[model samples]
Target: MKQRTKARSVALQVLYECDLTQHTPGQALEQRLAEEHLEPELAEFSRQIVFGVYPIVDKLDRYIAQHAPEWPLDQISVIDRNILRIALWEFAVAGCTPVKVAINEAIELAKTFGSDSTPRFVNGVLGSLANRLDEIRQQFQREKAQEEGLSPRTT
Candidate 1:
């Protein structure tokens, strides 16, 4: 697997565990890092994904729930949910990855970690959200600016 992809996998593992158990995300991430030999950059990327998505999980879920109305947030598999969170965070919140790359990476992760129909499910939901990617990103930006006590920049 590619290093960045491996990092995302690690993040998914941590998120999955934390979602199901009382294990703290920090502790889970620390344990996973110890178990795996990730390069510093990749490790940091994993940390970024975990922390980035962890705090805003409910917000991500709201978006996921909107797009995947057939599956309640609690009904979505932990692995699939975390994979979506990772991909959404990468492209939408962090704005560090392209939409296509994030969606493709998400599909890859789903194939590896999810059930038989997971890839298609993930693709469908993300593809639906892709139509409003810019709008979502802008809303998140506004929320962040409000939280940080800064005015959102006008384009």
Candidate 2:
């Protein structure tokens, strides 16, 4: 695995633990990283991806629900939900990571840690949702433009 992809998986494991135990990412992952004897550079990358998702999680969840509304918020598995959040944050929100890379990385994570069905489920939901991204763009673009005095109408 690529270094960053492995880092992301490590982060996902920490994040999964956080959800299960109700611990903060920093505290939880820091302890785990120390005990696991993980490399320093990879540890930092893992921590960043895990904790970094918190700030934008609410907004990310809203869009995720919009895309996958048939499954209620509570009904969705925490691991699946967090995976989508990480993938979306990197590809859709950050605009720095490529969509293909995010999706591929997520599939690997699911295969490693999620259910036997998880890899396919992860790809299906994320792939379908990611494909319908014009709506996501429209939602964010309009809001952002309005915030910046670029509303799409004549004064």
Q: Which candidate wins on lDDT? A: 1
lDDT per residue (tens digit) for residues 76-129 in model 2: 788888888888777776565787888898898888777887788778777876
- Say which candidate scores most in TM-score: 1
> Model 1 off-target regions past 4 Å?
153-155
lDDT of 2: 0.77
Score residue 74 of candidate 1 by CA lDDT: 88
Q: Every model's Cα RMSD, please?
A: 1.2, 3.4
lDDT for every model? 0.93, 0.77
Model 2 spans with C-alpha error above 4 angstroms: 134-155
Worst 10 residues of 1 by lDDT: 126-135
lDDT of 1: 0.93
In TM-score terms, candidate 1 sits at 0.95
